[model samples]
Target: MLSNRYFTNGIDIYFDNVCGSMLDAVLNMTNHGRIAVCGMVSQQRLSQPEGIYNLFNLVIKSITMKGFLQSGYLHLFPMFLEDVVRFYKQGKIIYLEDVNEGLESSPIAFAGLFSGRNLGKQVICVARE
Candidate 1:
């Protein structure tokens, strides 16, 4: 829903996919908001990931913060795929991905992800049938 729009009031469920803007996210979050930390691509390439501060806002605003990995939802893959396909067909979503074909190009693709060179979902395709 936040593709190219603005929030009138404030954010409700903030998904921290980038992991570099916790301070700003917390600042704009409504009371009792929740944060789901999924990806940390911003700090993936760094030798030392940047530390997050101002966590007291979570207490003051009564926010909940949690981290999760994609594998955690492995059981829901089929249902998720069905929904995604239906949404795509209905034109509710636009899928974008950067695929590097061949195992030899995986290094380049992986590097492109951390460097922001890839435009969308980074994928290293080892084979095609």
Candidate 2:
């Protein structure tokens, strides 16, 4: 699957999870690039997992690696909300929800979070708050 990515063309940014070959290929590319890390899909057993990207290559290429988390922009929430609402209104940001009916479904919904069974956001239907 990584081979099909064809990162040989060089990309400005790459997002991957624990796919060392993909990261390695991106690093090996002649042009500089950046990678956005969401999760490591390959390292499921390790208590503390690490990415496969080579530090030497990253330094040589002047690539930037960054973590994307909402908390990092807590201070920018107000500005983010303004843009988010505009995007939502324009129908640019579409959300997929897995809604399991019944109060007892909370356990199942929570389990999906860890198992990756939920393709998008997972929600359990209970009494409306």
Candidate 3:
């Protein structure tokens, strides 16, 4: 779900609609509120077409939106690795992966990612890298 709210400076935020509509959640925001964009559930193909995002609200709010991914910070991989390891060792982190053996299953594994069929990360194990 996507929503818009106005603070001192109007900033709009889009929330994942897994549990409820993000659009409804942000309508009551005050001034100078901040929004962090992580993922989009409105992109899903569901029984109903999701509501359109209010671009006008964003423009009026002067909202600042930002997104981040691991690949974008490849240079900081070492630091990320260390932080992740500590969290993992503390049992504060969990991961899921779908591993397919043999090169023959590579295509299937790749397809899973595009289809969102794989429960977690999809990995293909080839005899050679």
Question: Residue-wise lDDT of candidate 2 within 23-111, one digit each (tens)?
Answer: 56556544467778766544565576545556687788788888786567699999989999999999987555878988898897776
Give the winner by lDDT. Answer: 1
TM-score of each: 0.55, 0.50, 0.40
Model 3 alpha-carbon miss at residue 62, Å: 24
Model 3 C-alpha lDDT per residue in residues 39-58, reported as the tens digit of each score: 54444545665563543544
Clashes of 3: 6
Model 3 misplaced regions, further than 4 Å: 1-79, 127-129
Best-to-worst order by TM-score is: 1, 2, 3
Model 3, 90: alpha-carbon shift in Å?
2.7
RMSD of each: 6.3, 7.0, 10.7
Error of 1 at 30 (Å): 0.7
Model 1 lDDT, residue 68, Cα: 95
Candidate 3: lDDT of 44? 56
Look at candidate 1 and give me any clashing residue pairs: none
Candidate 1, 64: how far from true, in Å? 0.9
Predicted model with the maximum TM-score: 1
Which 10 consecutive residues of model 2 have the lowest summed lDDT? 1-10
